[model samples]
Target: MTTMTTRTVAYPADGLTMVGHLALPAGTDRRPAVLLGPEGMGLSDVERRRADALAELGYVALAFDLHGGRYLSDPEEMLARCVPLLSDPDRMRGIGHAALDVLRAEPRTDPDRIAAVGYGTGGAIGLELGRDGVNLRAIGTVNATITGRPGEAARIRCPVWAGVGSEDPIMSPAQRNAFTAEMQAAGVDWRLTVYGGALHAFHHPPVDHPTVPGVGHHPQHARRAWRDVVDLLAECLPVTEDQSEVQGRLLTEPR
Candidate 1:
């Protein structure tokens, strides 16, 4: 395995002290960075692991927080917070911008070469960042096909790729159509992948805590969605030659 470093970072957003996980690849050279977002339940080990994996791939990754460092395992509590936040694009943008600031401030991050990849609520935040005119290389989201306000999507300057479960009740077919229509009307480069026979949050692993209805995990689709996100990064925010060579050596070196 590639050597990397991980640390917990605390930043303020949404009137709360947000605690996030920052993962840095091995080496001193600055590299491309990704602002990673977590599901509505908030930042968990799953997102932290994703950030670490991104670092392993030679990208600086920060898994941002949503709930002031608290993981909401209760369905009701999660909805109580996420539902209103999702409906408010400004709030979502605030959260996204705060996390972006943290990511960009890192010396290891190449500010000009940054992407945003988020899941569920986090995915919505990434879209909001795009709509708010953040200069991102790309935006890749899973289970967050959210439509922005009137004519707002025109502000998005980069390509967007979204993945959702075909049977996701939270982001239904109608919602997907609306989101795509907005993107099309705004002349944004966008793509959507629907995982057939899957439900909402299908990209997430099964949690031990109670979840809302219509949320289930599909292992096959989860891996596929992850690959799709990685491909998006590879195309839009590729690592430099030095980092790639280091990664190659790490892969071939004997354990």
Candidate 2:
């Protein structure tokens, strides 16, 4: 397999130091980019690997941080930080914009051709970015069905794909309905997929630390959800010709 270069990037967000994981494709040419957001636990290896995988597929991917590089193992701490942050649209947009600026500043990123994908709390942040009227190519989210504030959803300018486990208590049926309703009311191009028999955080790998109730991993669903996200990106932000050449040279099928 061709080696994709990866790096740790530090930036500022909400008066705190934010660390992001950046992955670049093998070649030096500019390419489409993605802003990856992690779950409430923060930017773990899972998000890093996801960025690497996207880079391998010929895009500049940056796994943006949430808690200034801190991983919240304690459920209470995670909720304490995430609940308020999620509730405040300005805070979410600040975090997203900070990381997005870092990704856009990368020489290899084609800022005009970028997507945002996130999981759990990160997913909510991605949605907030869209609601803030950032011109993203696409938005893909998992395990998050949070609705935006009144009249804010209309600001989203890109297609959105959201996935949630059918059994995710955190994203209940009512929440899903509200999210979809907002999208529909705004006339945004959006789609939702509910993976059957899966629970909250189903798109994540098995956790080594104790997780709160309703959080579990389904390996099969995780991979499928990733494919769904990839499909969204392919539809909205197709790779450039140079990227296709590099991907072909790597002997891997196009993502």
Candidate 3:
């Protein structure tokens, strides 16, 4: 296994003291980076683990917080906070930019080679960042089929990949069509993957707490979505060849 360093970083965004998880790959040489966003419930162990996994793959990853260090398990609380936030493009951009700033400040991060991958509300924020004209290498979102303001998508300068569950009620067929239309009209390099028979947040792991209706975990699809996200990163913001070899050797080394 490729050993990595992980830490909690506190920063301010949208009047909240956001606490994000930062993961750094082994070695000091600069590497490509990813801005990771959690689901509507906020930053949890799942997202932090994802950041660590990205680091193990030789990328600096920052899993950003949504609720100022709080992880909401209550569906009502999550909806109350996320519904309005998702509607405001400016707010989403602010959060994304704040996390981007944090990621760029890392000494090991390559500012020119960065991608944004988010889930649920986090995915919407990543799209907002792209629409705000942020220079991202790629944007990958899951379960966030949201359309931006008129002509704003034209500002996106990188490829975008979106994943959704075919049966997701929150991201209805109409919403997906609108989102695709916006991207197509803007001339973006975009694609969408629908996990058949899955419901909303299917990419997420099973949680002990109660969730909203239509939200359920699909392990098979979740793994596939993760692989797809990794593929997108590999295509758009690959790590150096030497780093790949190092990671390969680490994985093969005996204990």
Per-candidate TM vs. native?
Answer: 0.94, 0.93, 0.94
lDDT of 1 at 98: 96
lDDT of prediction 2:
0.92
lDDT of 3 by residue, 107-225 (tens): 99999999999999999999999999999999999999999999999999999999999999999999999999999999999999999999999988899999999999999999999
Clashes of each: 0, 0, 0
Residue pairs clashing, model 2: none
* lDDT string, candidate 1, 35-117, tens digits: 99999999999999999999999899999999999999999999999999999999999999999999999999999999999
Estimate candidate 3's alpha-carbon lDDT, on a 0 to 1 scale. 0.95
How far residue 109's Cα lies from its native spot in candidate 3, in Å, is: 0.5
TM accuracy, model 3: 0.94
Q: Which residue segments of model 1 deviate by more than 4 Å?
A: 241-255
Angstrom error of the Cα, residue 156, model 1: value is: 0.4
lDDT of candidate 2 over 78-128, digit per residue (tens): 999999998999999999999999999999998888999999989999999
Q: Clashing residue pairs in candidate 1, if any?
A: none
Ten contiguous residues with the weakest lDDT in model 3: 242-251
C-alpha lDDT of candidate 1 relative to the true structure:
0.94
